[model samples]
Target: MKKIKLGNSGLEVGEISLGCMRISNLHKKDAGYVIENAMESGIDLFDHADIYGGGKSEEVFADAIDMSTSIREKMVLQTKCGIRDGFFDFSKEHILASVDGSLKRLHTDYIDILLLHRPDALVEPAEVAEAFTKLKASGKVRYFGVSNQNPMQIELLKKHLKEDLIVNQMQFSLMHTPMIDAGLNVNMQHDAAVVRDINTIEYARLNDMTVQAWSPFQYGMISGPFVGNEKFPNVNTKLQEIATKKGVTDSAIAIAWILRHPAKIQPIVGTMNPQRLTDIVKASDVELTRQEWYELYLAAGNELP
Candidate 1:
C-alpha cells in the first residue's frame, strides 16, 4: 500500500484507492469482508458517489464499518454529488443538501473530500463556491474536487472557489489513451491529434491536481474490462507476458502501467472480490521499465506518429 500526497492538500492517501460502486450489491457480511480485506491490503481511500446504487452503496458501506471516531480517523472517505436523475445540478441548494444526505447515509461527521460528480452544463460557479464555503466553515467537508471535467471547466470552478480543487477523477487506462494521444501527436494531422480532453493530463500536472484514474482496466467507457477480454488478444498477450516476468497477475501489470506514469496518478480499483483486490494491490510493488511500459501501451492499439 504505497501512499502519496493528494494534490497539494498534503493529505497522504493510498496509491490504490477502493471504488465502492459495486459493494452495494453484495450482502452485508460480504461487503464487510471485502472492506476488511482492502484495509488489510493497505488501501486507505474509498471512493463513492451519491447516486451509486441509488445511495444504497453508502448505506451498505456504513453498515459494514463501525464508523467509530477511531476507525473513521484512519480512513479517507471521498464521495461525489451534483448528479441527479438523468441530469446534473451544482446549485448551492443541491450541493448543500447532497452533502447532508451523504453524511447521514455514511454515518460520518465530516467527509475527507467531496467532489462534484460530473460537470453540470448549467453550473453556477458562485453557487458552488458558496456551498463549499458553507460546508468548509461548518466542517462538513475538508477538501473539494471535480470529476470528468476538462481543464477549462475546472478553471471556471476555481475562479470562484476559495478552496483549491485537489483532484480530477477521469477514465484512464492502458486501453484508454485519449489523454495522452493529443500530446504525443501534437501539431500532426493524425486522428490522435484530436485533443479530446483539451490536454487535461498536462493541465492537471501543471496545476498540481492529482488525477484519479478510474476504471484502470476497462477499455471503452462501458466496453468492460480488457485484461482477459477476447476482443483485445494483443493486449492480453502482452499483459500475460509481463505478468509472468514480473511474477504477478495480468491485472497487476495493468495497474502498474497506470502507476508508472510520471504524473503520479492515483488509480481507483473497483473490485469487490477479496482475492482479486489483493492481487490488484500487488501493483503497488511492481514498477514497469520504460520498454515494458511502451510495449503494453502499443499493444493496447495505440500508435506513435
Candidate 2:
C-alpha cells in the first residue's frame, strides 16, 4: 500500500485507514478477522473515538488483538477525546482523564495521535495546551489534532498550543462536496457558493495539516451510504462504471475518488466486513484521472460554475 506523511508531523501512515467505530458490536472472532485482514491489506493506521459505542469499541479491539505489544508496534493508533455525555469537554481535567481511560481500554502505553473530537464552545485553549503538555511529558500522546473544527477554531487552539495540530477530521465524500463546491463557485451567486466549512480544506492545505475524510461514502451525516441508494442512482451508476473498468469494487471507486484529490486526504472507512475492507483498500492501487475524478463529482449532482 502507498504511504503518506500525516500532515507536518513526519509520521508515515497507510494511504487508507480503518475506522473502528462499529467494531463494538462484532464478536471477538469477527473483530480479529477484520483486524488481521486490514493489516494484511497494508492498512497500518486505525482511527478510534472515545464515544464510539460508549468505549466498547476500544475494549473489543483490545480483546480481539489481545493487546500484544508487538502487534501494537506495527500499527498507528489514533483516538479522540473531549466529547462527553450530552456535551463537550476540553478542560485539562477531562483531557487528562480521557487519555488515561483510552490508554487503559486500548491496552497501549500511548496514543500515536490524540484529537479533540469536536469543538467545545466553552473551550479554554490554555487548559487544552496544559493537557497536551502533560500528556506529552508523560509519554501518553505523540501528536495532537482536532476533528470537525473550522479554520478559525483550529487557529484558536493553535494560539496556545505548543505542538502543531497535524490533522483535522471532517465529513467529506463524493456526494458531500461543499468544500470543493465553495472553491469552484467562488464569487458566484449559486447555492453551491455557500461556504459551510469556512475554507477549512484550504486552511489545512496551507498549514500542512492532513485532512482525514470520515464517512467517505455517505452523502450526509447519518444519511446512509450513497452507493446503491436509489436516491443517488446517477452516482451509483458512475461508481459501477468506473469499478468495472478498474476491475475493483464500487467501494474502491468511491474511496479512490477521495484519495485522488491533490490534497492527499486519508479516508477513514468504517466497514466491518473483512472482505469489504479488503475491497476498499484497493483504492491505494486505483488512481482516478482528472477527467474521471470530475466526472464522478458531477455524477454526485454537483455543478461547476
Question: What lDDT would each prediction earn against the true structure?
Answer: 0.93, 0.93
Cα lDDT of model 1 by residue, 112-158, tens digit: 99999989999999999999999999999999999999999999999
For candidate 2, the 10 contiguous residues with the lowest summed lDDT are 219-228
1-305 in candidate 2: lDDT tens per residue? Answer: 89999988899999999999999999999999999999999999999999999999999998998988899999999999988888999999999989999999999999999999989999999999999999999999999999999999999999999989999999999988778899999899989999999998899889999999999989877588888898999999999999999999999999999999988999999999999989889999998999999999999998878
RMSD of 1: 0.7
- TM-scores of all predicted structures: 0.99, 0.99
